[model samples]
Structure formats: structure tokens, C-alpha cells
Target: MTGGTGLFISFEGIDGSGKSTQARLLAEHLRSTGREVVLTREPGGSPGAEEIRALVLQGDPERWSAETELLLFTAARRDHLERTIRPALARGATVICDRFADSTRMYQGLSRGDLRGAVDTLHALMIGVEPDLTLLIDMDPEAALARAKARATAEERFEDFGLPLQQKMRAGFLALAAEFSGRFRIVDGNRAPEAVAQDVRAALQAQA
Candidate 1:
């Protein structure tokens, strides 16, 4: 919205909110509309970040300290931003990421303390390159957790957290939406995937 360079869009939500599905759909739509686009996800977009993603999601990051997990997230973000996100935008391509720095804040913040330092440092390090738009796909905690559990062939680190933690994570997302205001849009994630996709398209077009 601000320059001749390409745009960066990020999709964020608690697990099972269908943000990933919607991100894919949006990328497809952009391709169909004849825009150059690259579809990727946080924690594992690039090789370096993928390594960090394994550590963050593979075994039991929930079992570790909240602060440690938050650091890992930022580490992954640094790798992702350097190797993937920034480069795509510089090349004049729309980069659609399924998750981004906002997830770190919500997840870490929900763990009952601030990741303010981490968030600040990440913003400082990244400087002027950040997502142009972030769509936060919102859904009910109970339903989202239920869907996630059923869909999971096996649990990942964060996914293994208790119900109370999941609730906090869900609330954290909405809180983040409130905090960021106009930069983030909340999408109804409980509907059909196609319906959700349409909502995302409208939001992106509105911003355009």
C-alpha cells in the first residue's frame, strides 16, 4: 500500500483456526489474478528457520520455560525474515506467510508474562521490513482445539499443552487484534474453508 515494491501478508491464529488453509487459498487467488506470489509459513520457511522450527514444534517446547520457547520463535523469525520474507518482498512478489512475529507475542504473552523484550528486539532487528497486512483468523478455543486434536496424527510440542493453555493462546490472539488495531483483521474461522477464503479476499482488497 505504501510503495512500488511488493506486499507482504501474514496469516495468524491459534492452531486449527484455518489460517494456513486461508493463506494457501489467498496465494492461489493472487496467482490466478496474475500477481507474482510465494506461499510459506513461519518457523520453517527457510532452511535455517526450518531447523529452528523443528526445535520449537518437534518434541516438547511447552515442557520448557516460556521464555525459552519465545526465544526459539524469535530465532526462527530472524532466519525466516532474513532468508525468506525480506528477499521475496524485495523482488516485487507478494509473500503470503501463514504465521509471523505476531504468533511469538501471543504465544509468549499468553504464557503469563511479557515477551516485550523479544518483540522489541525483533522489530528493531527487522527495522523497516514487516508485513504490510496480517489477517488473524479467529475461532472458538474449544472447537479449535477439538479440531486440532482430531486432525493431528500425533501431537507437536505446542499442541500438547493443556486445555487451559490453549484457552490462553486463543484469548491471546484476540488480545493481539485489539492491541494492533487496524493492522490486523479478524476473520471468522469457524465457517467453511471456501467462505473463509472469500472473507480473506475481501479484507485484502479493502486494504488495497
Candidate 2:
């Protein structure tokens, strides 16, 4: 965490795609190699953001609109950047986050409704920098949802989206990765988690 420009990396994927597991593994890999890493996630990484996370993911799904959801996500991101991301980066630590701006642009943006306006607004207002590297873990959303539902106590609002919509969402993620070339990596999430982590490591190493 000393003397160099900080690098910010973010992971994105459909639910049950195992990006969270891989993100932790990636953090450990970086740390073991003597890199200072801060692993965090959004709609989280801060107290206020955690509360927002519960509301966005676990609350009554039918009651909230697309705009409401987007605003809540950005609200959490603002806190996350100020409280955790900035400080860690200022120390030159590599910051890996579970989800960032891309998730909202995909899930709440393209999938739920037209969020082009919101995206533009937030892009202007956010930390004013994008991830140095973003991994959009690519997995079929149906497979992901099935895996998630099998392990769930109950369905959250997000899990209720049908398979067809989830597939569309997966397409949305692919489109995003295409929109940004080397800066984004799409990992095959259907593989074993460690195998996926290996791919992530390879991708990051190429950049370094």
C-alpha cells in the first residue's frame, strides 16, 4: 500500500455465479504475493451501504421501482467510495469489489428498465474513475438461479426474476464487457470456482 497509483478492480455476474468466492480467492492470491489488497463489495463496504444492501436485495420486491432501486444503489456506492475505496486506494492498496457500477448498469439498468439517464448521471457524479479492471463472470443465469434457489431459505425479490429475464440479463453483461475491451474480463462461471479464480489471476497478471 505504498508509493504507487492504486488500482481498483470490480467483479460482476448473475447471482450464484460464484464471483464472491472467486473475489476472495483473488484477494488472497494478491496478498500472498505481497500486494496490499482490500477486498470489499457494494451495497456494502460501509455501514450505511450494508443497510442499503438489505433493502435492495431482501426487501419487498414488488414495491420498488427501477428508479428507486438505482438511486439506492448509487447512495450505497457514494458511501462505499468515500469511506472505504478512497482511503484504501490512497494507501495504494489494490481494491477488489464484488459489484460496482457495472452491476447496476446491467441488472437495474438494462434489465429492469431504461437506465441510460441514470447511468450518465451517476457516471458523472461517482468517484469519477472507473475500475482499472472489471471481471464480469459469465454464467447462464438459469443455472445460477437454480443453484441459488436450491441453497436459499426463501426467494428474495431479485431471485424471483424469471429465467428468460435472467438470460437477457446475462446478455446485458456480455454487451457491457464488449463495450469496454481490455479493461473488462469475462470469466466462465460454470467452471469450478478455483478454475475460475485461475482465469481471474491470469487476467490480472496480464495487466500487471
Candidate 1 overall lDDT versus native: 0.80
List, residue by residue over 1-208, the lDDT tens digit for candidate 2: 1223799999998877888898999999989999999999987999999988888887565668888888888889889988888889888899999998888888778888898678768857764667889998889787898977776754367877758767887888888899987689888998989899999999998888
lDDT agreement with native, every candidate = 0.80, 0.84
Question: How do the residues 1-208 of candidate 1 rate in per-residue lDDT, one tens digit apiece?
Answer: 3243889899998887888889999999999989999899987899988887767677754465777776777777777777877778778999999888787777775554676676667656653355789999998888887877787644366667757767888788888889887788999998999999999999999998
Q: Give candidate 2's TM-score.
A: 0.93
What RMSD, rounded to one decimal, does every model reach? Answer: 2.1, 2.3
Task: Extract clashing residue pairs from model 1.
Answer: none
> For model 2, what is the error of residue 126's alpha carbon versus the real structure, in angstroms, after optimal superposition?
3.5
TM-score of each: 0.91, 0.93
